[model samples]
Target: MEIAIILISALICMSVVAIKLSDTKLSFPFAMKKQLFTAAERQFLMLIERAVGNEFRVLCRVRLIDLLSLKTDTNKKLANSALLKAGNKHIDFVLCDKNDLTPVMAIDLVYGAGKDGHNVQRDFFVNGALDTASIPHVRIKAKNGYTLAEIRECIETKLIPLRRRQGKIPFVAANDRPEVIKRSTKPTRPLSTSRKAVA
Candidate 1:
């Protein structure tokens, strides 16, 4: 009887341990759901805007665009439309330089929502009309559930590089001599000699 009781107690203790571990695992999703993403996301935008200048604005419009779908004209249109609408919401943080307001940079923070809100980052860019060749709008892929600082740092790294790379067209022409160099000119007679001969 004593042996049986001891075995039963051990089994109960093991079951409790297993249950606790399962509960700890289960609590993560709930914590994620409870996380206040918007506030931190907004803070990140504000930080960038403050650091850069008031000319550029960062827009967080993950809800409007479907990240799972392939890129299409319809998606593009929808994304632009959403940004326009977001502008009305005024959820952006402006970046400014001393000379002028920088062009607004749109960032979409895509999170896997509902059943699919896991391990997905959907981002797109909308070029602002006021944006110039030097300063263009950028799109960034933000990892879901990242802290505010992490998101800001990621955006900075990604966008700074993108802005640097935008207008660069790769050299595609052949290594052969250029057309201008290939044009041969006849030997020119000396100016004095020509004049003397004419005289």
Candidate 2:
């Protein structure tokens, strides 16, 4: 009877794995999302792009692992545990330095005031990680009406100055936010109307 029971258990486990294998082979009922960002997110992204100007490049939907990693001294087991705990969590947007693509600031778009404790804890972890790395974290409320000036003030006036003092931002950037300089291309020499130059 004990042997029969053991055989039955083995069969049940095999059946379970077989079912899982078949499920994995089947195509999931997935549909492609129509848009990556909602209208509000798109608006905020546009504001960030315009506000930071050509100084910084903006990246969206970046994973935390992509931005940060555990210290080298961390043991493999501890590292795996920490990574497993935080894996798959992502930042909404990351602003990077244009020169070497270093992550300058991490931005989270606050959709609404409806966050629960879990979200608060997750944000705490993310913010703490950014702080540990000396990278600034900014949370901007999602609004349809974010002006370029307001975003610029938050980034340039507030965050950039602090990072600049800390030497996080490279001194290569100008004191003033660099603007596109338009040089009107005029003929170096006046075009002679007479065709005699062709001879």
Candidate 3:
């Protein structure tokens, strides 16, 4: 009985030591810090927020994989290809339906004419993916501060046609139309000069 009790005590000590060693081995270092957005991106997001108001939700730096999915069946090759194409890419901004969070439009802020070869290739790939998925996309130049009217114009010109093609009408409810009319009739506020140009 004495020997058994000693062995039991030894076993408990060993177990405690093993647990501590495992915890020490598994410990990892991590840094928690604040992430700063670019000045241009900040300004752009502000513009998008003001332009969309309460009508739509604007999501910034959304991953392509989150927005897109493999439409094909369980073919491994096709699935892998789709993943490879979308895995590392992200859209600058995505306008989503306020009610259901369904993606309505994707906007990419292009600096200059996108003359860089890498940028051109990336643009082609992103545009192709959006087009193949039947998602409307607009490439806006990173110019001096964009006005609310200009942003609305871009949506009307680029997204409305796509929405129509998909048989989706904007604000179909009679009650919703009145709110839109009321908002449209309101005077437009001038954009601030301090707004930064998007890069």
TM-score of each: 0.28, 0.64, 0.64
Query: What RMSD does each model have against the real structure?
Result: 16.8, 19.2, 19.3
Model 2 score (lDDT): 0.80
Residue pairs with colliding backbones in model 1 are 53-95, 53-96, 54-95, 54-96, 55-95, 55-102, 112-117, 113-117
Where is model 1 more than 4 Å wrong at Cα? 1-38, 46-98, 114-149, 159-199
Q: Which stretches of candidate 3 lie above 4 Å from their native place?
A: 1-17, 24-28, 111-121, 162-199
Give the worst 10-residue stretch by lDDT in candidate 3: 113-122
Report the lDDT tens digits of candidate 1 across residue range 1-199: 9999999999999999999999998885533456445664565565565555444444344322221222355577776765564343321223333355443344433344522332243222323322422333333444435455665565566466455465443444676546664545777666565343554
The residue-level lDDT of candidate 1 at 44 comes to: 56
Error of 2 at 94 (Å): 0.4
Residue 164 accuracy (lDDT) in model 2: 73
